[model samples]
Target chain A: MSDSPVQRLFAEPGLEWRSVSPKLTIERRLPLLGLLLFGLALLAFGRFVAEQSEAAGADLTGALFSGLAAAALVGAVVGWFFVVPRVVSAWRYAEREQDLLVSRGRLVRRLTVIPYGRMQVIEVSANPVSARLGIATVTLVTASASTDARIPGVPVDVAQELRDRLAAKGEALTAGL
Target chain B: MSATDAAPAAATQASASASTLRRLHPLTPFFRSWQLVGALAASGFGVFRDDLDKLKWIWRALHGDVEVSLLMRAVGVLLLVALALVFVSWLSWRVTGFAIITDASPSGTLLYHRGLIVRQRSQVRLNRVQSVDVNQPFLPRLCGLAAVRLDMAAGEGASVNLAYLRRQDAWALRAEILRHTAVARSRPTAATDSTEGAGGELIAEISTARMVQANLLDGVVAWVVLVVWVVALVVGGVVFGWRGLVTVAPGIVPVTVGIAVQLRRQVASMMRDANFRLRRTPTGIQTSSGLTSTINRTIDLDRIQGVRLEEPYLWRRLGWARVGVDIAGASDQSHHGASLMPVADRRDAVALIAEVTGARLDEAAVVPAGAQARWLDPWVARHLGVELLDRGAVTRWGRWRRTQFFVPYARVQSVSARQGPVQRRLGLATVYLDMPSGVQRWQAQHRDMAEAAALVGELAGQARLHRAPLRRLEPTLGTGDR
Candidate 1:
């Protein structure tokens, strides 16, 4: 059976796709895991201090403190082990002749399209943790306030290349306008 | 004043007059003081009323009698406030002034000087004038005065405003400025002659019944009232039993009724003139609207970025729609600047869109999205698609309320394509046409990824091909026919 016009229009015509660096996943997970461990240690230290105060005959409410700390520790552990990996895996970006596409989200997915001509600025930045992990984020700024398109967890070299290409394309395209 | 000598003499007179800075209407200070009086009345009544009540309670509690002197003091304070307000209004009126100076340049630069103490002076090149907004607030309207605000193509802070001018003077200034700045490049002399023939021709008039229906169906009152009523009933019933509903009923009724009345009045005021008129001249499309304070806005055809056709849910059922446009430098942040036709049938809307965009709706072929798009946008799949035209692209989408955007190749700021995780899995992508107006209508979603990529590439090429340098039309020699 022939496909309907709607099906034909939206049917996948597989094109060459470029994937981000696989090492980005490890880079994204390290900081999150570190933060989680740090938070757990802080909470444990607080609970210990509260218990020590209770032992010294002051009503320090050790039970309630410990319960809150345990709950937060559980939440941190879940976020570190579960949420971070999924979000990092979902991050993907593709460059076309005229525009750049960035998609990221686990459940409620969102895709942003940023054209080279519309990009007022293309910036690549890395924080201390990401730099240590050899990853950087690329941000595309436009005239509209709402559409802030950013692709995180790309290798530093890839981020720099994308920024330069986008900037060059933007300059070339904007000259006509 | 001979026909030959009259020209130079008039020019000299205009220059001489322009050199002298002038003050605003003497009554401007009084108009500005309206807020002061309102503030005084509210605070005075509130504070004095409470003070008097407290005093009476104290007297009754201690000596079982209240003195009348406290009431006299409150009255005296109220009178004093009124006197102070009048004095301030006078001072403000004395300081405010405006002047329009024709600079000694070929482009006819207009230097606008205004302000009381700080004295602000801004210059607007006559050719750069994009549109003029004539505003008359309640007091100014009653006093037969109006304010003229000139919107320029240069970014923000470029607009010049002259307030509290005689209504006739305001109209004259608008015409004179338009005439001075009118750039007739390719048009024949006959077109320029028609500009002075008469005012605009009435195109469409919104009926009172339609206005009321639009107001009610515009989703401001009906949905809000329904949601609030339901939430109130459910929550009140749960919290305080049947008596809770009864207690909330009286309060809700008065508030809802008050809001409904206010909303109706606001809609009515917005559609005061009710007539959507358009006039074509050598320079641009001229329009006048509003009942209380008539606004005259001029839309230069060259400055128009794109046009939008919208059908709200209720209006869609009735086959009614509205048309608006995105003009460069026009303050479209509010609905006032972009409004072309407030309400019309689909046919009329299409006609108006064609008139503005130079593209007929029927001429373009509509292509629906893929069947798999139903999974992504279940409500919009059938209605959403892109229409490729020779000169531009038109995209339509929405379930309850549909919107069609006409973006010409020359006006498209950028083109982009996106594919999310689900879209990647489904092989679908969304294409965006970033326009100058930042409106959401210019997007085509849920197309095949390859098709979207192809469309983006084609659109970019077309944009480059159609890109024309913006040129200001030179004033035609000897066409001073106006």
Candidate 2:
């Protein structure tokens, strides 16, 4: 597989680097699962409408039903195969001396950097499935709930260790500085 | 007089000793247990119904054939009641404990105890305390008991609850906290020798006139929205189920009346809670909500990310303005800077603007210069894109309100540029310059794209300058006082 080119690229200036477990496929692909579920729901709704139209003894031919079915199938297929991998590959974290950087998104690149010392909390949360898979999520809460940044799919052990380290480091920085 | 005073003092001591303040409510566990059991029973009904329905047992229970099972059901219910009572009573007995331990050492802390079966202790230190909130529910007011919550800056979900405190004790504790925090901030120490001296700034309290401004929506926009919502609901009901008029009449009228009553109560409560006061410590200025549970927030003057003043069509007619601040605090409920004022009086706005920016608005200053006029005048002209024909000029004073404000450019912490579809179509954008304090929210509306971009660039430069390296400031100056 020509050793994924992603592993060779290094971070540039103004970027901090953090690593998420490469093995965390299921956890990292959660958004894909959500898309899949939505597509399936839409498909079912379209089919139900089609059946209702037929039972009413009318030649209920509508573009909406067909269009929705096609859209659902396309969404399901694309999300499952194409979007998930691209999203995971682009996902990276960087813990700089100044800020914690999280960069992701395939087409529209989004890079969020929150200054480290200003971080209010480092909360480590793990679901049972994630724990079984040896991954945990770390949410770095700022004063604002809406803008809080979470880095999920981190290896469970590393996540906990990072949480403790960040909490201690952040508090010390505030107290000492 | 001495003998009579002694007798009265002894009687008073006896009565005070007999007071229940030292004791925890015995029904604490009962209330908890009742809530738990009620929730469980309601859920159980939903869970167990599937199997019972499959076997048609529910149908049998509803008919006369239930006679045979009636005795068993009655016995079962009685047993459940008895079990519930025993469990709740025992838990209440075990969990109920109340003790207020006040420690006046340098640590300055308060201790609270409650619970019978499962005892709980909440320890709150004075230094960690951010604010003390006392709430009086209808029942608590009648009982002369209030729920006091101490919010600490330790992070989220870090509050010590003194569930039931006498009204007097709650007030006393709040006052004590305020005094202690104030003393700690003002006190100086060698370690904190680097900070600058305190700058005196006046923050106007919410006067009755201000309160009226804050609730100006009572007669205008609020009523219109409410009426529209009610009308919509009634129309929907009539269209959907007009055949069920007789049965629906009983439900709709009461529901509508209940909604109206609830709205009235909400408005009244919000008005009562519309108190605003500026709280300042050595660290920074904080303008937070008072009186109401919905809008409580504390924003450090330095951390304000953006500010905007909104004057809707109706508000403009009413000579009012609403100010909103954007802070790091979770913006959903609290810490979202938004408030109403009946009259945007220049003096009041100027005073608020001064407190936030650490600069005074000098009266008789040249138009939009020296202090606020310098930045605000150009800010309004360049950013607001005021045409000569347009009355919304660079001047701080509005035609109706005649209020003026002078906010400095350097105090701005953040600037936001936003343009909606309509604004884009109109070739206009809105610019917001956020100040760290609760005042000096400068909004320039309907600016041309070029002007907005230029303002954004200028504000960005100012923000960068203001955001100096924390290390540059002497840490000792701000610390040892506490």
The most accurate candidate by DockQ is: 1
lDDT of each: 0.66, 0.49
- Residue lDDT tens for model 1, B1-482: 11433343345345644336566777776777777888776876687686797756655645636565755675688788777888876765655444444443343555555554676545565656777666777678998998888887654567787887887777666766665565323333223323322654445667757765665676555557757866876887888898877776887678768767766766664565454455665555666667666666777777777777888888877888877777765554433337777778899889877877687875767877766898987877999888988778888887776888787777666565555677766778777776554344367888875577567667767765665534452241232222
Residue-wise C-alpha lDDT for candidate 2, range A30-106, written one tens digit per residue? 65567667767766776776667765533344356556657766876786678766766766777655445565555
In candidate 1, how many clashes are counted? 1
Q: Kindly list the per-residue Cα lDDT of model 2 for residues B1-482, writing each as its tens digit.
A: 12323433333333322233354344334444666677777876777776676336646766656675775785699579758776866655554443332333243445554555456555444554555555555445555665556665443466765655566665555555545544444443221211112122324456756565456553455566568867876787688766665566776678668667766865774554455555454444534343533232334354434433445445555555554444332223244344422235445554555455444434333222122222333433422222111111122434322333333443333344445555544445555554333344555555555555554545545443343432212332343242
Off by over 4 Å in 2: A1-77, A80-97, A119-177, B1-105, B134-147, B154-157, B161-168, B182-219, B225-266, B269-310, B323-347, B356-482
CA deviation > 4 Å runs, candidate 1: A1-34, A49-177, B1-19, B52-83, B102-129, B152-160, B179-197, B200-202, B206-246, B250-273, B312-319, B327-337, B420-426, B469-482
Full-model lDDT, candidate 1 = 0.66
Docking class of 2: incorrect
**Candidate achieving the largest TM-score:** 1
- Candidate 1 per-residue C-alpha lDDT over A65-134 given as tens digits, one digit per residue, 9 for 90 to 100: 5566677667667766787677767666767677676656665455555656667778888888788888
